[model samples]
Target chain A: MLVEIYLIAVVVALACSLPGVFLVLRGSTMLSDAITHTVLLGIVLAFFVVNDLNSPFLIVGATLVGVLTVWLIETLQHTKLLSNDSAIGIVFPLFFSIAIILITRYAGNVHLDADSVLMGELAFAPFRRMTLFGMDFGPKVLWSMLIILIINVLFITFFYKELKITTFDPGLAAALGFSPVFLHYALMTLVSLTAVGAYDSVGSILVVGFMVGPALTGYLLTHRLKRMILITLITAVFNSLVGVKAAFVLDTSIAGMIAVVTGITCLLAFLFSPSKGSIQAIRNRWKQRKNLKKQAASSHIKS
Target chain B: MEQLLALFSDYTFQIVALGTGFLGLLSGVVGTYATLRKESLLGDALSHAALPGIALAFLLIGKKDLVYLLGGALISGLIATALIQWISKKSTVKFDNALSVVLSSFFGLGLVLLTHIQGLENANQAGLEKFIYGQASSMLLSDVQLLLAVGAGILVLVLLLWKELKVFAFDPVFTQTLGFQTRILQFILSAMIILTVIFGLESVGVILMSALLIGPAVAARQWSDRLGVVLILAGLFGMVSGVAGTFISSIGRQIPTGPTIVLVLSLIVMISLIFSPKRGLIIRWVNQRRKKKAYIKQIEEKQERSEKYAR
Candidate 1:
């Protein structure tokens, strides 16, 4: 059961980190945050239709709402009324609050609640088994996340060039016949899908951590996109394993522990990464001061 | 009508309504500066950072005293803001990244501490979770008193430094050149903003408090460009939303007060977006249509003159 929990965490981290690199590079970390929250509305509306938390329709509904969230944000941004951050700060809460209100009013008798939406329980994931043909499979969350992870990996692999072009140089990509707008929506859809898949295990808030933290840590360590992606995966897996152990030891929310671990990992990279770390910069400043002192002493001796 | 009057006359409802109204007014005033400076999301980060502070305060005091909890939240929120500034300045990381790092980490810590406190068999821990979603209906008279004090302080400070703040917000370099201690002023303003966030957190929760901050300011911006009018309009909008949200939530037993306030604020924003006379979408669309018609009319008249000359 422990191993299964670990596996699910690892898979979730992988799924989020893949798209996270793009989001971080594009400077849309806040948008990812918005999508994660508004996807709750999609889940609730879908739950109302299907009346089951485990239905696949939830993911589909959530992905559409995620796209709508992006559209609304973009529409507000294009209005030149509110800044990008304010647009995001406005739209998600509206959608999320509506969802919370609905859940409190209509879904009171059901399993859906606001607490689980914010802080999902990963420890319980292991007990919710999936059975096929009267044979027991592993945890349902692990299977679902595995499938989503595969989708993310395949999507990233196939659209590697397009995503790279669009993320770095949208104008150039458009000039080269690739629609940056289409790519943006496509990426947003995938992000929505990832959020929906991970919602049951890690909840919405931690999804932002998983999506941004590892990718950012990797970014601090490396300059190349390929190397960044590799570092991000390593960091994600490391954070998840450490987080599981920490949560077990502390008897806290596993997702919260994971987010906290991801934060620490990013902080460590921020302070100590050899290429771009603050420590290196400080050391260089010290060395430069020493060189200045040595040169001044030599000049005095000559005089 | 009688029931409405009775609801307003009720002391508990009045406290909740007035407390939320003050929250709206304070957040609106501070949020104007934040929104104009493009630091709109700072409230989000600060509110989340306050969670750990609230939890830590509860742990240290071994009780759920509102004052100590709010003080702890204020200290942590200040730290989070400082860290955001420090990281953005000291490293190559951008401000948004730094903001997210501090927000998620602090919130994660808060969640961990909250869960730990919940397991401690302490009776005081029962209401700690209310800070997450915020139960304005559950607010005590003491909380309302705190809100009144903080709200007055915020209003007075904003009034006292109104000119300097306006100058500082519009152009910091100019403010510095004019021999102002721009850094001190910026620090004070940020502290006030953080205080406003902390004040609203008990009513709006950490997640939706940013909306309260941004929503009214955004709505006011649509109606006016002047800073003073915008501030006044924002305060008014916020107050209206606060009262309406409180009243509406009171109507429905299960309606969450925080989100209800947020939704009310959102509704105001939507209304302003479409109907506000100055910068509204519909108004702009109508102006564009009129301009197009005039341009076409001028072109037709010019064509008639050319044809008459040719004949």
Candidate 2:
């Protein structure tokens, strides 16, 4: 059961980190943060329609709302009325606030509490088994997160070129006859889907940690896109596994511990990565300055 | 009508309403500066990053005193702000990435601290979690006094530094060229933003507090181009939402004050976005259509004249 929990955490971290690479590359990490919050509105409204918290339709509803959030922000940005960040800042809270109001007022007696939406109930994942034909298929969270991970992997694998082009230079992508706008929405849909899938496990805000942290850790270590993705995947698995053990020892929130671990790994990479680490940069600068001083002294003595 | 009167007469309602209203006003006035400087999302980051501070404060003090918790939150918020600034300055990482990373990691640490406290089995820790979603309905008169005192101080500071802040927000390079200390001004503004976020966190919670800071300022910007007008309008809009949300939530069963206030503020934002005369979408659309029609009309008249001259 404990191993199953770790697997679920790993799956969630992987699922979040894949799209996170794109978000980091595109500089839209906060959009993931916004979508995580707004997806609650989608889930709540879907709950009202389906009247079932565990309904598969909740994911559909959430994906739609997430797309809508992106659309709204883009539209607002096009209007020149508000900047992208301001648009995001305004839209997400409106959605999240409404969702919270719904849960507190109408769905107060139900299981959709706001705390679970933020903190997530990862420890309880093992108890909710997915039984098929009376045969238990381990934890339900593991299966859902596995499927989301597969989808993220497929999306990135298939659109690697288009995504790469659009992220780095959308104008070039457009010149190559690829619709940057379409790809943008497609990536956002995938992000929303991943957020909803991981929503049950890592909650909302921590999803940002899982998504941005590992992707960034990878980014700090490498310049190549493929290598970055490879590094990010490794970082995700490493962080989640270590986080599970730490949580078991400390007996605290698994998601929180995972996020802490993610942050630590990213910090390590930032401080120590060979190419981009601050320490390496500082060392290089100092060595260069020393070389310059030596050259200047030699030139002066020869003169 | 009687229910409304009864609500007003109720002491808890009065305190919560007053506290939230002042908080709204404070966040609004400060938030305009944030939005102008394109730091609107910084409030969101700061609020989330404040969690660990609250948790650590509880662990050290071993109590649920609001003052200590907020103080802890302030210190942590400042630390988070400093870290974000440092990372952005010291690395090639984008500012947004740095903000999100710091925000979430700090929040994660906060959660860990909270769980640690919970594991300690302390008696006074029961209500510490309320800061997560906020329990404005449970606010005491003293909380309001504290909010008002600090809010007034910040407001006075803003007024005193109004000219310098205005120039700094619009153009920091220009502000520096004019012999003003832009770094000090930047620090002061960020501190004010952090203070506003901490005060609102008690009522608006971490998630929705950004809305309180951004919503009113965004809405008010739609109506006016002048900085002073935008600031005053945002403050008014925030106060209205605060009071109105408190009222609406009180009348409803199980309705939370934080989200309700946020919803009210969102409504104001939507209205301003669509209907404000100067920069509103609806107005812009209408003016564009009128211009298109006039252009077509002029072309048609010119064509008719050409045909008559040819004949």
Candidate 3:
């Protein structure tokens, strides 16, 4: 049972971190934050129409809302009235606020609450097992998260070059006949789909943590895109494992413990990484200064 | 009119509305500095980060006291801000990356602490979860008074350092060149923003507080380019949203105060975006069309003169 929970956590974290690398590189991590929140509104609206929480329509609705969020933010940004960040700040709250209001008002008797949306119950995930024709398929979350992970991997593999070029230099990508806008929306859709898939177990806030934390920790350790992606996956898996163990020991929220571990890992990398750590930079500067002094003394003696 | 009078007469309604209104006014005034500094989202992160502080304070003190909880929130929020600044500065991570990571991780830690508290055999823990979405109707007279006093103090600080803040907001480089302590000014402004978030936690909660901070300032910016005017307009917009949201929510069954306030504030932002006299999309569109018509008229007259000359 615990293994299933860990599996779900690890898979969800990996799935989120894939698009997160591009988001971190493209400097739009906040867009993921905004998308995560707005998808709740989509879920709620879809629930109103479908009257079912587990229906596939919820994911469809969330993805559509996620795309709509990006479109709205971009349109508002293009007006030049506000900065892109401000545009994001303005748009997401509107969607999220409406969602909350809907849940509190008409959906009072439903299996939805703002608390569960923010702090998901990961412990109960294993109990909700998947079964087909008297055969046990393990936890529902595991299968869903696995499907998301496979989709994410397939997407990254097929469009690796296009994603890389567009993320690094959209102008070059456009000049080379690749539509940056299309790729961007495609990435955002993937992010949203992954977010909704992961939403049931880790909730929205943890989803943001899973997406940004591992990618950033990887970024601190490597500069190469492939290396960064590999490191991100490793960090996600490592954090999820440690986080699960720690949460079990402490009897606390698994997602929160994972997030805390993510923070610590990023901090450790920031302080101790060989190439880009601050401590490493300080040591290099000191060594350079010492070498310069030695060279100056040698020159004086020769003179 | 009678219902409005009755609402004012009701003690609970009066306290909640007054407290939220003052909160809105205060955050609006202080949040301008944040938005101008491009740190609007920092408020979002700070509010979420403050949650663990409240839980920790409750654990240590074994009670749910407002002052100490807010103090704890302030301390943790400051720590989060410091971490964000340090991470972005020292690492290869950008500001947004640092922000999202710190924001979510801090919030996640808060959740862990909250759940731990929930498991403990204590009845006092029941009220702490209200900070997540907030229960404005539960506010007391003392809460309103604390809000008023702290809000006034912040307002006084804003006034005392108005010139420095304005300069810092518009151009930190210029502010430093003018012999001002840029770091101290930044600390002061950051403190002010954090204070606003803490006070607002009870009224608007963590999730919607960013909207309160960002909405009013963005809407105010649309109306005027002047900083002072924008501040005043933002305060007005925020106050109106708070009071109006409170009233509407009070009348409706199961309508929450925080989301209602945010929805109202977003309405103000949308209206300002589309309909403001200056910097509005509608107005800009109209002006462009008129200019195009005039230019076309001039071209036609020039064509007629050239044709007469050719004849």
Return the top candidate by lDDT. 3
Interface RMSD of each: 1.2, 1.0, 0.9
Error of 3 at B166 (Å): 0.9
Q: lDDT by residue for model 3 over A104-135, one digit each (tens)? A: 88899989877777778788888888899999
Candidate 1: list runs displaced more than 4 Å.
A284-303, B298-311
Candidate 1 residue-pair clash tally: 0
Count: clashes, candidate 2 = 0
Q: Which RMSD does model 3 reach against the true structure?
A: 1.6
Ranking by TM-score: 3, 2, 1
Q: Write the per-residue lDDT of candidate 2 for residues B1-311, one digit (tens) a residue.
A: 88878889998888888988888899999999999999999999999989999999888889888899999999999999888887777888888998988888888888888888888968888877777787788888888999999999999999999899999999999999999998899899989999999888888788888889889899999999899899999999999999999989989888889989988998999899999998888889999999999999999999999999999
- Please state how well chain A of candidate 3 matches the true chain A, as a TM-score: 0.96
Which lDDT value does model 1 have at B257? 91
Poorly placed runs, candidate 2 (over 4 Å) = A291-303, B301-311
Interface RMSD of 3: 0.9
Candidate 2's residue-wise lDDT over A182-234, tens digit each?
99999999999989988778888899999999999999999999999999999
The best candidate by TM-score is: 3
Error of 1 at A226 (Å): 0.2
Best model number under DockQ: 3
Better of 1 and 3 by TM-score: 3
Candidate 1 vs candidate 2: the TM-score winner is 2
